[model samples]
Target: MKGRGQESFVSLPRFAARLYNALTHTQAIERQHREIARDLVARLARGRLLDIGTGPGRLLSLVHELNPELELFGLDISEAMVHLARKNLAGLNVNLQRGDIRSSGFPDDFFEMVTCTGSFYLWDGSEECLEEIFRILKRGHSAYLFETYQDFDESAVQKALKANLQQESLVRRLVTPRLLMSQLRMTYRTNEISDIIKRTAFADSYTLDPTSLGGPPAWLRIRSTKPAARA
Candidate 1:
């Protein structure tokens, strides 16, 4: 049997696509509604930005709108999803590439800022992954990670998915929420994730819920920095 570590890369790309066509064909559109009206753009002003797990690139579009001069690079695991993001965001000055954030090949101190939305919980190597992000980013560069906080256990869910993941496309998967939920081995609490980030070497790590923004339950944001002394 292959390991979860070996399979995480494969599962990530399919997660968004399958969730869309499988769970809800209009998932992207639904996400657009909540995000466009949300504090995501206000939190991520402009200039050099790295968008991790940039599913379909709606957040990219929003950031661009917030500031046209924003130089944005997007990375995701799904090639097909990248295509959709490219097509959906045509004529805009953005660089969207297919890559796993776990190994983004950009040089260190490259970006002024970084952001991930709806995908942080999917990461298998949390501390290591953040260290990589910290490595590539300039000191004091801000990062925003928005993910589900109220409904699941981050570890157990990923563990189960890493085991029985089907090798299929979104059109083929038609992945139901029930099917996905069943794979989850545990439930997650916000403080559980909060404690993980707070204990990391990264400073200023904190969680912001919907109450922090007067919004919905699935909303959560973490703001952090790479220690300037390391520079």
Candidate 2:
């Protein structure tokens, strides 16, 4: 989903957001969210954390459960998503905002950790967004970007489908796998993503983790740190 211009800022509306909330409640998705939360909490056990494109807010919920002392924040381009996330995360101490990634409305050097999952591909002006991430993240902190990848072996795809979607409803079992596979074809390959990250300050301090999700080879993680070279 590489792109340029206004089309890059996509958001899910009320109905789509509701459907998304339901569809993503599978074991596979939950496992992915848990892994991401654990990795972030392990790296920065207690600090402000910002989750961009926080659809349904599942990841932040997990983070809070893992470490309730950490301050949590979430940003999404869709108002409906923000509302749904708020309802889902009711009683939790989280700050949810409606905004765009290219221009996150936060102070520079503000957050200890930043994360985006399954939504990085929809971003337009990705380099600009990366710069924003670098600017807001405190020096020596990190940002983890997780997205579906396109270069998995066919057997891996089949195994993932069986593990993640086999017990789903007939419609979901049939439609979800096909939808995911199609998007997989359209997503960034590891090298393409590497090239893009290479254009930003994170280039010097980033590493790719092919098995970050700890399940199928369906997702790729790009962990980038802001250098502590400057004060």
Question: TM-score: which candidate is best?
Answer: 2
Candidate 2 has its poorest 10 consecutive residues by lDDT at: 2-11
- The residue pairs that clash in candidate 2, if any, are none
Per-prediction RMSD in angstroms? 7.7, 2.3
Question: What lDDT, from 0 to 1, does candidate 2 have?
Answer: 0.84
Candidate 2 residues lying further than 4 Å off, grouped into runs, are 1-11, 212-214
Write candidate 1's Cα lDDT for 90-122 as tens digits: 999999988777778889888888887666666
Candidate 2 versus the native: TM-score? Answer: 0.92
| Candidate 1 C-alpha error for residue 10, in Å | 2.6
lDDT assessment of candidate 1: 0.62
How accurate locally is residue 85 in candidate 1, as Cα lDDT from 0 to 100?
76
